[model samples]
Target chain A: MTAITVDRLHKTYLVPEREGGLRAAVGALVRRRRREVHAVTDVGFTIEPGEVVGFLGPNGAGKTTTLKMLSGLLHPTSGTATVLGHVPWERDRRYLGQMALIMGQRNQLQWDIPVLDSYKLNQAVFRIPDADFKARVEELSELLALEELLRKPVRNLSLGERMKCEIAGSLLHAPQVLFLDEPTIGLDVAMQRRIRSFVAEYNRRTGACVMLTSHYMADVEALCRRVIVIHHGRLLFDGALEELVHRFAGDKTINVELADEHPLDPAALGPLVDGHAVERSATGFSVRVPKAETPRVAARLLAGLPVSDLVIEEPPIESVIEQVFEATSAEVDGG
Target chain B: MTGERLDADWTSGPRQAPGEGGLAGLVRHDLRILRTYLSLGVLNLVQYRSDFVLSVVNAVITLATQVLGLSVVFGQTTDLAGWGPYDLLVLIGVHFLIGGVLGLVVRPSMEAMMEGIRLGTFDFTLVKPADSQLLASVQVVRPQALVDVLVGLGVVVFGMTRVQASLSVVDVVLSLLTLLCGLVVVYSFILALSTMAFWFVRLDNVLAIFQSLFGEAGRWPVTIFPGWLRIVLTFAVPVAFAVTVPSEALTGRLTYTSALSAAGLALLFFAASRWFWFFALRRYTGASA
Candidate 1:
């Protein structure tokens, strides 16, 4: 079952451009200038039921804009999107009740009130039954470990604690589709892992489709099996995380720990491999060579010098993603 | 059987626990928010005890001034537009009463709506299932305005008794209905004004203009104004319906035709404002997209 279907969705914003100085500001009062920004253009995707898909993109790359469209906070400039068979922008109460959108920077909880009070307000808005509402709140509180925090005013809670409450509040109605835009942003690694695990547990138990966009890769890696990468308002890659690494990573790193510090010329080792990249430390050095050339490079190094220890490692995910984006931009520029 | 069982399990899936506990629960809900607003309004009035005292003093001074002005005018002439001092006092009292209600909820909410739009907090309102217009209008309650309401009601009672007018139960009912209609008219007028925030982002002066005009024109009967100005206040801005017509109903000067007209106008404006709210919401979401 497909929980979300977005087809050729387009969203453009007309942002006013104002020059500095009093003269330009005064002139703007009479006649303003605007430039059209196509925040999302011809983007299309579908999420299967219960699938936790990570939305990956650079800043200003239309990730938030697309999520806003999906969540019914925004209307697309063209095309259409249906979540759970309901058009999002229409804001049908049934559709809104069945879905939740949590933004990291934007808060829905009332600042002066206790977190529990804010949740109660959501209960009324979502029309949750009393029994169901109570059970749901208890479950969220226990899972998020929000036993003590619920009594305190939202303004008093820490960022991580507030985010937990915010997520819990949004899920009170047991929404079938959750759109999370940077839900774990600005959180410490521990808090991020806590939220990631909570989300994973929620998804596993409920089978609700979750589409999360975050700058933190740990959030994506921990929770999402399938990731959708978008760059410059276009889908760059949509597949498994491992596949993304394989497609973008060209070489593997071989680090060797020597018995003692040794001075070695990088140029001398270069001729033995198709491509040679080397970084040296006091007791060890890491070298990157083409995957196929790893055996030949390792054999040549071992024969040439006494090797104490060696380990092979795949490139970091961040670097692989950056390389993918760089190659994509290069292709676009080439055209 | 297996497919049916799977469907049933999927439909009746595990429910997540509620977010807040009991007291926090009440505050979080919408109805509870309204209750808290009212209680907080009372609490706020207690906190500003001096302001409340000053307001009552101000109301007494204002009522004294209105009576003195009426007496001075009637001294020179037996009657101004066929209304004696007491009749006009009733009108003045009704004006304050209606204005008090507006100040209590309508005006503050409109101002809050404008501020919410400016601060981008209106998005918090849009996501809720409640009608955005209703939520924005009743989000805050002003306890200070209750003094005006009480003073206005007191003036109405004293004026009626002093005039030696026979106040029947039917007359009281009619007056109440007219007052209710007047309140609706004022609410719809403010709502329509606040809805303009979607298009005219810089409309701070717009709501202020209504208050200033009402301060001046609401003091007098609509008949005292020139024909065009009276029409503008009556139909265009509907301030006449808010105060003048309702006061006339209490004073036994209201005609059936005018009462019907006020009622019709209130209904029309209420529907129009509701339509405008949805339209503004559409434009807001569309433009932001």
Candidate 2:
């Protein structure tokens, strides 16, 4: 069954226009000008039940806007979306009770209260029974390793700890759908990994659908197999993660470590296939080669040099997504 | 990599959410949420004792200045605009009472609502199943204002005792009804003004303007102002409804027409403010465009 289906969703914002200087400001006071900004234009996608999907975009690409629309926090300028068989913008209590939205940049906890108290407030808001609330809190605390952290005030916890508590608080009701917008932003790598694993496990346990948006590719790599890429408020790509890499990033990286500390000569590697550049480091050199030529280049490097450690990897997801953004923008510019 | 799957199943509750119930049930749920908010506010106050002390000191200084102003005005004249010393005392007490309620709940909540709209955190409020206005109104609880309210009650009692006339039950009940009407009017006015933040984005001075005007005009009867200013105080901003009308009810000087008008205006303001709030919310959510 489909968990979410957003059809031709569009959200356009009319931002007031103003220029600097007192004269212009006074003029604006008399009669303000406005310009329309198409924050999300014709964006559409379907997310199946229990499927974890990553939303990838740079800032202002409308990822958050789309998430807000899906979570019923926003009303789209046009089109419609349904989550778990209910129109989201109607904000049906049953729908809201079955879903949760966690924004990493913003916190839902009271800053001065203990994290557990905040969880209790969510319990009341979501109307979880006392026993169920306690059981769920215990379950989430165990999963997120949040035993001692719940008693401390939210302000007293570190960013990572606070985020973990936030995740726990949002899930106290055991929502069936989760819209996590940059849920791992500003967290350290370990904390990010911990959250990703928790989300994956939560999905496994409950069979809930998850749609996550993040700047951290590691989050996507660890948690999601499918990704939707958006740029300039338009959908650019929607497919499997491997397909994204294969389509936009055609090259694979080869890292070679010499058998001994010796001077490396670029000329010796000479005219690497397809004129790909070799980047030399203190201990090793990495060269990018087309996916088809990866085996040939590996064979040549082993046959020619004293190669001790060799590793071949797809270009990092960060660089690959960046290339996709640039490629899409270049296409827009060309058209 | 997919994490190891856990076989734990969701222990689902076969029940609808609290807000999905009937009207009476929804009211009960909202009241429960309000109790939680108030208790959380008390917890927050425990952490900021200095703020509590400051608020106490502020309330003291405010009452002292108002009392001293009464003394000064009484020294100059036995009565101003047909209002005697004791009558004006009741007015000042009513002013503080209304101010205390606003400070305790309405003002802080409105400020938080403005900040939330500015910072985009208000979305959390919208996504909740409960009524958005109910959530926003009780979102922040300022316990410090309890001092002002208690002091205002003390002032009202002291003023009424100092006067020669004993208050009949009808008088007290009438005063309370007017007070409720006044509070509804004031709250609706503040709400309508704050809702403008969704469009203006810079209303920092808006509430300050209300406070200043109310402070200046609410101490006296709107009748004292010549013509235009009295109309503005009574109709435009409703400062007269908040303070003077309740005082009139207590002083037994309220006309039946004025009392009826207060009730009618309270209803009008409440309905209008609620309508404007939803309109602004629709605009903010881009529902119109």
> Which candidate leads the pack in lDDT?
2
List, residue by residue over B25-78, the lDDT tens digit for candidate 2. 678778877888778776677776898899889988988898898899889998
Q: After superposition, how far is residue B163 of candidate 1 from its true place, in Å?
A: 4.0
**Poorest 10 consecutive residues of model 2 chain A by lDDT?**
A266-275
Candidate 1 ranges beyond 4 A from true positions: A18-33, A263-267, A270-277, A290-295, A333-335, B1-80, B85-89, B142-147, B286-289
Taken over the whole model, the C-alpha lDDT of each candidate is 0.79, 0.84
> Which parts of model 2 are misplaced by more than 4 Å?
A19-27, A145-147, A255-268, A271-275, A280-285, A295-311, B1-14, B285-289
Clashing pairs in 2: none
Kindly report the docking quality category of candidate 2: acceptable
